[model samples]
Target: MKMIGLVAIVASLINVSIPFQSRAETVLSARDLFDACTRADMDWISFCNGFIQASNDHAVRLGMACTPAGTTRTHLVEIFEYSAARLLVSQSELGDAAGLEVASAIIGAAFPCN
Candidate 1:
């Protein structure tokens, strides 16, 4: 499916769509993000990019709560991608909250403020 907007969908899925909405992005449900990210309708490149963007946004936001010092944004995105991959493997059937939790955990574990 059209996965270009998966980020906004994900944000809404976790009840945090203010940033996207403020940017004029449409808020979609978790089902939509899941479909767009998992379905084959979208090309691999687009899907990969979407995931990268999604992971980037998630990591940056989570980093705000912690001191991710000495960690570059690029590195954070990469770790987030790995976390996303792990989520896809095991949490695919779970709800959107599950995904968000895992993402936060990944960032927190990798770059804890304490």
Candidate 2:
């Protein structure tokens, strides 16, 4: 039957795709984050913002960073972009670093508590 053939095709397709999905990297790298942040696409920009905000939140909770009361999300993004660029350029190995680690370092350095 055509329906049975179609079902078999669909099942085979799903099986083929599973390995690729599993191989996808779950952790975002600093280079990838920097690329996303620098993109002109709104979707990428939004992704960058969300990722930075989440990283900032975690860093704050862990006492790794101390954001000033007047600091805005845009400010945080700027800080990350600038710092990440310099860091990635100076330390090429850091491009492979976890996004969270890079973001936390940037945030902490930008807003260190005395």
Candidate 3:
């Protein structure tokens, strides 16, 4: 009887935790955000592997020069240029102007093109 009670308790705990995992979602495409921004702000290479995967997927999607090198600083500069151009055009669309400026500064730190 004790064993059965313990088993039931464990089962209930598992059931309760299952939904929590499913309800959580990735907030942003780490690579897209990094490419559009910077590594320093993102803890430097924390998202490298994931960013590479996303970039490869994007490369396949857009047929652009996005190689497996997307996670590297060199590749990131190219991505930054593209992202900056897009962001410049869509400045009015950004809801948080200050946040965008900060992000731009962080990205610039990695590649001081400006």
Candidate 4:
């Protein structure tokens, strides 16, 4: 019946890998991400959040951190910029690896599981 068809569609969508190009997949520098963040670039913020969400999702699965209820995403951008600035002192590219670094640092400071 209709329920069976709907269940099949949901099951099929579960493992589908949508096109999500993380910073590592691109060549933009960390400086740029930070710069965009300073200016509050909507596009950059959107992309940055998307990137962080993926990292956070994985970290949650590993029980690394627990996001406080009612926490706003604004913190994600703050953490991203903070981490990027710290890292950019040496390296340049703020690739997806930086996203992971950001997530780890933020988890400890902002959402410690303890």
TM for every model, in the order presented, reads 0.40, 0.76, 0.31, 0.52
Better of 2 and 4 by lDDT: 2
Which candidate number would show the highest TM-score if scored against the true structure?
2
Name the best candidate (by lDDT): 2
**Candidate 3: clashing pairs of residues:** none
Could you give me the TM-score of model 2 versus the true structure?
A: 0.76
- Per-residue lDDT tens digits for candidate 4, residues 18-109, read 32254335544335545666666678778777666665666576676687776566776676566556555543332323434444444444
lDDT of 1 by residue, 1-114 (tens): 122233333334456423433533344333344444554554743764455456545656756236345755446546656555554455453233543444444555555445
Give the distance in Å from residue 100's predicted Cα in candidate 3 to where it truly belongs: 18
Candidates arranged by lDDT, highest first: 2, 4, 1, 3
Off by over 4 Å in 3: 1-25, 29-37, 61-73, 85-89, 92-114
In terms of lDDT, the poorest run of 10 residues in model 1 is: 1-10
lDDT of all predictions: 0.47, 0.71, 0.38, 0.51
TM-score of candidate 3 on Cα atoms, chains taken together: 0.31
- Whole-model alpha-carbon lDDT for candidate 1: 0.47
RMSDs, each prediction? 9.4, 17.1, 19.3, 13.8
Give the worst 10-residue stretch by lDDT in candidate 4.
1-10
lDDT of each residue in 6-95, candidate 3, tens digit only? 223323333444343353353332234544345455544545444444544443454433244335655654544454444434442321
Which residue pairs clash within candidate 2? none
For candidate 3, the per-residue lDDT at 103 reads 30
